[model samples]
Target: MKNLVNFKVAVKTRECLVQAIYQMLFNNDSVAKVIDQFKDEHKTKKVDFKMFSMSLRSINRNKKKIESILTSLEIKNSSMELIDKSILFFAINEMLFGNLDKPVAIDESLRLSKKFSSPESYKFINVSLDKFFKTLS
Candidate 1:
């Protein structure tokens, strides 16, 4: 059932779901703290803890890949804020791991930026994801 939920999210709204996960990770104050809190809070439940753990590990393991994608797109150290990095990470996760269609990934990134980030930030995300998509082809 948990796998079914993940599969549905991955198939139907992969980019948005990855963006949500990245947002959770990036804004958690600290990854370790977040994990600790999650463990403490959810340990009593009979939820799919293993899948959640795998998702967290996958995010952590792909951090460098995410950063590399942003750097390749010239996001720039000076311009890359936490939110910007989170967008990049989510985009890369969708592109590399989530099985989302390319245009869907790009469009969803743009939409997420427009909804959650500043106007200027949306432009940055648009250009970056556009460039990243071009490289994939």
Candidate 2:
């Protein structure tokens, strides 16, 4: 029998989107690699690969800006986990580059954190995103 645990059923949630973004970034060195990696997994879910691709592109495009913003928020500490950093990068990319709503972005980031990271990380992610938003106005 196939391992059901590896198969994620179809669902549209910010967490999944963010996860996809993180996976695409962390697992692959190029778009072709990402597509190859996700090709099998995505068959079980109705994920918007286009959206994930766009997010990846956006993040790469604004990589410098995003890094500067994160640095400004003092997130350069090596203590942070890679998952937490991915969450922050996804949240920041969607909020600042994609023009997603602040509340929705923050809430989604929190939800993602609750699922993927520690409870303690939610507050830090929220406050950090909030600070980044403040710079926009």
Candidate 3:
């Protein structure tokens, strides 16, 4: 179905978004550099490139606001893995700025954490982002 196809691309985009964020942290690359690298790497994939680029740009643009929220939650950067931190940043950015529903953002973040992070990281991500999500209401 068309919906299934769209869902795949959306999932791929979210995966890429989290990776891109991780790269920004892990590689110490500038947003512009990461964007360019991701574009080149995913040029032939079935990624929703527009959404990936927009979400990354938005996440980069709103870094300060996102950090402020995380600070309020007392989420210390060193305490979490880079992947978990990236997932939180992506989820919080989506919940705050992207068009997706908060639940979608949270669910996508959990999915990513389960796929790429430690077995127990999703629980931490869920609780932390849920706390952040509640503040938006």
Candidate 4:
């Protein structure tokens, strides 16, 4: 597997990635359209198409696993904010699907939580991931 840390794209770059995902999830856009829009918006903006493509593919490929993780964590119907779900979904994507190293995945997820979520969100994410991993053992 590739080094997931090396695969760690910037938060802003990931914001673009998630935007494409959100478009797909919320707007029902096709993958090609999402990629096209992403390219048009960031073609010359130093975005890593490789990372963006990989992350997008990861999310799409692991949708079921992500959903399972959310369900397993019992947050599927909880009243937690969307940001919380986003953080958990992202972490689960990395942990249960991405080929990145486990520590790298956790770190990247925490970084994302810090950047895009509330301060307490990281702790919540960390605990959730820890419990999820424990269930795997």
Candidate 5:
């Protein structure tokens, strides 16, 4: 029997995306390895796999560029918690390169931070992403 949980595809996809990125940061796993890892997890089966894969692939392909862009925000990711950095990287990449709208990317980033990071980390994520957007306008 399969255990199924009810989660919106977008929400679950982003949740897994953050975790996959965090895992990659720590383990330095290739995108294929990480996607295979997620695919092997029954708990993650409900995610929007296309969204998750495309986002992860885009990030993988463009992570350095995205990192440079976010680095320009002066957040000093070198000192950031890995989870926080992962969340910022995940959301900002989605905002700039993926199909999600900017607001949705940001909102989902905050939500992911709240779920997986320090209690106050979401606030920092919010301010950082906001600053990134301000520079764009």
Candidate 6:
């Protein structure tokens, strides 16, 4: 994984990552198109493109595992909205596969939930991650 915090960088790196994941979720375009569209639509002038790119790659590689974790956490795909599902994908990928810290993953997921999902959906994000991580221990 890329060292996003190693040197001077934009603070919205995490946001851009989440946005890329959300784009992958909602848009029917290919990953390349979604990334290009995200960058073009958001006017991401200073965003860390590596962060978004690596996150999308990780999410795509472990997509089945991420979705399986979600199912084990009882977040049924049929019951959840697209935004919440996207949050799960991003957070789980970070927690399980990416190089980010666990708390950072949870916190960023909550932030994304607040921004893109229902207010109360953050609780589900928190609880699900907690449960999933606990099982790993």
TM-score against native, each model: 0.64, 0.78, 0.92, 0.75, 0.90, 0.83
Minimum summed lDDT over a 10-residue window in model 3 is located at: 1-10
C-alpha RMSD of candidate 2: 6.1
lDDT to native, each model: 0.64, 0.70, 0.88, 0.71, 0.84, 0.77
Please give, for residues 1-137, the per-residue lDDT of candidate 5 as tens digits: 11224446777788889999999999999999999889789453568777788889998999898888877887786689999999988988877887878887788788888889999998999999999878767
Q: Which has the greatest TM-score?
A: 3
lDDT of 3: 0.88
20-62 per-residue lDDT for model 2 (tens digits)? 5566557646655655566566657666666666766777778
Candidate 4 worst ten-residue window by lDDT: 1-10
Query: What is the lDDT, from 0 to 100, of the residue 31 in candidate 2?
Result: 52
Candidate 4's TM-score reads 0.75
Tens digit of per-residue lDDT, candidate 4, span 20-107: 7667776767777888889888887757788778877778778787877778777654566566565566667767766667776677
Model 6 TM-score relative to the real fold: 0.83
Q: Alpha carbon lDDT of residue 42, candidate 6?
A: 61
Score candidate 2 by TM-score against the native.
0.78
Report residue 21 deviation for candidate 6 (angstroms): 1.9
- Per-residue alpha-carbon lDDT of candidate 1 for residues 36-61, written as tens digits (9 for 90 to 100): 66667656654444444555556677
List clash counts for every candidate, in order.
0, 0, 0, 0, 0, 0
Task: Report lDDT (Cα) of residue 85, candidate 4.
Answer: 63
